[model samples]
Target: MTTKRREACPNLEANLEACNCSYEPCGRKGLCCQCVAYHRRAGQLPACFFTEAAEQTYDRSFDRFIQTWS
Candidate 1:
């Protein structure tokens, strides 16, 4: 079987420098699939989950994500 290639988000790729996701454990810094999977497994979104300032704080916790959205 052949392995499927992952797709990268052009928009995100162009804006990675501005992205604030601080969870370094993520393998997909600009890749949407890998990022989504990583967050899903951890029950959280990537650094892009919060504003630039908030993301800079490096708090990728589920509660923080909810607090931001709320």
Candidate 2:
């Protein structure tokens, strides 16, 4: 298995401004790529995929995403 390296996000500051993720202590907060990969591996969507209200639920499941839109 290949390990992926976590590098400093060049857009971290800007990304943080737009990030709506309600998870207070998430290490992947402003690292969009890592956040996406992590959630994808778990068969879920990232907080950024959800609306602000939905993101607060912290239910990153695909089903929840569909529910939010439906």
Candidate 3:
């Protein structure tokens, strides 16, 4: 399957307000598609899947996400 380059999300500014990622220097902070794709490629979920406390740990693993919820 081919992936198309996505346009910047229309809600980027609003998304940033709600983004809980604790990583200060992330390039993909407000770019949800890029953030999701980046993490998916690594078999993980983006920091948004995690709680603010969990996100700070920067573990991004799918297992960690589940453990956080469970």
Candidate 4:
């Protein structure tokens, strides 16, 4: 299992500016490290990997990621 670091994200503003995640209540919205690690542990990709349209589906599976990009 991967460990989560509780350090504050230094580039939060930049990350938020670039993030397209639409999940309103998401705790990992601007925390890229936590978001990536959480998604990786679930065997899926994060919202950033998908298009705006695809991201609305909330399907973060690896297969979905491939289909979205391919």
Candidate 5:
């Protein structure tokens, strides 16, 4: 896959401030676009969709997201 280099995002700082993903060392931590794309390809949702307590579970599944929100 010849992916283009990600441009420096303007919202990086803000995204980082709000991101709740508990998986440390994630390259996509503050990159919402990449994070969402990555999880979507894996048939999952990003941690931001869940509550703080729920995000800690690291499930990231659609069922988990729905269960957490609904």
Candidate 6:
């Protein structure tokens, strides 16, 4: 059996440098679709979840993601 690789979003490459979601051992980096899905399923958000200031705080919890977006 073999698994297929997910397609990479070109936009993610441009934003990886700014993304801070450090919880996952991922390769997608910061693309929205992948990031959102990954986080939503886990009840959390990607490193790009919060602003630079908020991200620096390292509060990647689900509650923090809502508070930041809300």
TM-score of each: 0.58, 0.85, 0.83, 0.86, 0.83, 0.51
Top TM-score hit:
4
- Worst ten-residue run, lDDT, model 5? 1-10
In angstroms, give how far residue 39 of model 3 lies from its true place: 0.3
Model 3: per-residue Cα lDDT at residue 24: 82
Error of 3 at 65 (Å): 1.0
Q: What does candidate 6's lDDT look like per residue over 1-70, in tens digits?
A: 1122223555555566666656455655556677678667877766775877677676668888788888
Q: Cα deviation of 69 in candidate 3 (Å)?
A: 1.0
Shift of residue 54 alpha carbon in model 6, Å: 6.1
lDDT of candidates 1 onward, in order = 0.67, 0.84, 0.83, 0.86, 0.84, 0.65
Weakest ten-residue segment in model 2 by summed lDDT:
1-10
lDDT of 5: 0.84
Model 5 CA deviation exceeding 4 Å by range: 1-7
Q: Candidate 5 residues 1-70, lDDT tens each?
A: 0132235576777888899889987888778999999999999999999889999999999999888878
Poorly placed runs, candidate 6 (over 4 Å): 1-7, 51-59, 66-70
**Between which residue pairs do clashes occur in model 1?**
21-47
What is the TM-score ranking, best to worst? 4, 2, 5, 3, 1, 6
lDDT of 1 by residue, 1-70 (tens): 1122223454564555665666675556656667778778988767777887768777778898888888
Better of 4 and 6 by lDDT: 4
Itemize residue pairs with steric clashes in candidate 4.
none
Put down candidate 3 lDDT per residue, 1-70, tens digits, no spaces.
1122124566677778889998888878788888999999999998888898899999999889999999
Q: Which candidate model has the greater TM-score, 1 or 5?
A: 5
